[model samples]
Target: MSSTRTGLLLVCLAGVLWGTGGLALEILRDHSPLSVLMVSAYRMLVAALALLVASVVLRRGPRLLALVRAYPGRSVAVGLGTAAYQALYFGSVTTAGVTVATVVSLGLAPVLLAVVDLVRARHRTVTRGTLRLALVLGAALSGLVLVSAASGSGAAVGTRPVVGLLLAVACGCVYAATTALGSTVLTSADADPLALTTVATTAGAVGLVPVALVGGGPFVTSDPVALGTLGYLGLFTMALAYGLFYTGLRTTRSGAAVVATLLEPVTAAVAAAVVLGERLGLAGVIGSVLILTAVAGLDEPGA
Candidate 1:
């Protein structure tokens, strides 16, 4: 298979892994004492620790350090932004229903990236294809809104719609910026994706120290199920998924990779239906289809 295809597959797999994270969070809510902020911190801490151990075992410590030293500001910015977005996303989930939070936050990322593309292309002649791509973005966002609406009807848990929307928007912006910054790391000479991911997680963990501590309490939990779930989140969702995502960036366009992650919400919806017995009504089905189509469309040669 082509490298591009491999990259897209890796990214799509990352998205699928990400979809399961919500379920893990739910488990934590039921069994763990960690607050949302603390959960984010622990995610970073565990992922960083896992990566560190792997680096030592694989004899890549020197290379990881080199990657960090080469792009200190960029690495820190990406990691810090990543942690900030996670905190904001969980905050939004509290204020906005999960559907609204996930859809809006993830939906806005591609739109923002497309806007950046348009700005960069302002000097060039506009083509019909570019216009079509813009329309695709609009459709994808529309699908997200539909999904959010369906979610409200089916299982609305949010109490503050306005606040949640704002937070979700903020999360999207941060997510977009962080993703863009992370792509830069791949462009650097002798870039190592594994090293970059290790550095990113480490930096994110350190960056969240103050905020996690401020949230306080609920930091320690003795429940084995909760502990195992937490480990799954860090190891699979953050570490493995992010590792694949960065590796994919080596071959995939950043914008396309972002769009490919639409699979995340779709995967989440399906998983909820199966695992949580959440019913995805007709509207949800339609929305998921639209999103899937949009995701596939973004992979067209020029797109």
Candidate 2:
């Protein structure tokens, strides 16, 4: 198979794995959101350990460590941003409904990142095509609003308070900023994607420790289902999915990679429908289509 096709396949698989975490999270809803956050934190720590071991075994230790040492500042910043994103996102969902938090956070992230990119491009002139891409992204933002409105009646829609919704938006902005900064730093360093992921995950896991502490009680695994859910999320969603995504990007064209990652929201939506029995109204369906269309329109041909 062609490298591009292989890359696309990897990305799709990554999305599937990533999507599975929501199901896991649903299964673990018995626990407090903070407890769940702790589970996620531990998962990151485990993933980092696993990746570190793998790197050594594969004789990539020097390279991985070198990358970590070289970009210590950028790596830590990205990792902290990632950790903050998770904390705020969980808090949002806890206070607000999942629908509200998810829409506000995930939907706004790309828009913010695109704006950042545009601002950076001001040092250089943006082409007409880039401007068109911006417009398409704007449409995607509109679609997110429509989707949120359509799905607003669900329990997860207003579960959290207004403050939670605001926090979720803040989470989105932080996530966007970290992602943009990470991309720039990684590109500049020619960092190994897996190694980069390992560093960021380590940083995020460390950052979560204090939050988990304050919100903490003894770690209790009273239920087998909860344990299983946590396992799935930590291993598959947080670790493996990210690994596949970065590796896939190495092979895929940049445009194709972005398009593939855009599948994340669609995957989440479908998972919600199937696992949570959350029905998407006609408006929601229309909004989903619009989002896909907008993403496709924004992806530059040679990106």
Quantify all predictions' global Cα lDDT against the true fold: 0.83, 0.70
Clashing pairs in 1: none
Model 2 Cα lDDT, one tens digit per residue, 1-303: 666567667766776686567667767876534376777676677777777777778888777788878998887787789788878987897888776777788777776666555565563666775767666666676667666666555554445488898999998888677766666665676788778777777888888877787777665566777766766777788778877876665665333344345556566666778767898778778777876776556344422
Best by lDDT: 1
What 10-residue stretch in candidate 1 is worst by lDDT? 147-156
Q: Give the range where candidate 2 is weakest over 10 consecutive residues by summed lDDT.
A: 253-262
Candidate 1's error at 171, in angstroms? 1.0
Candidate 2: residue 296 Cα off by (Å):
2.9
> Which number leads on TM-score?
1
Q: For model 1, how does the per-residue alpha-carbon lDDT over 69-104 read when each residue is reduced to its tens digit?
A: 888889888888988999889889889878778788
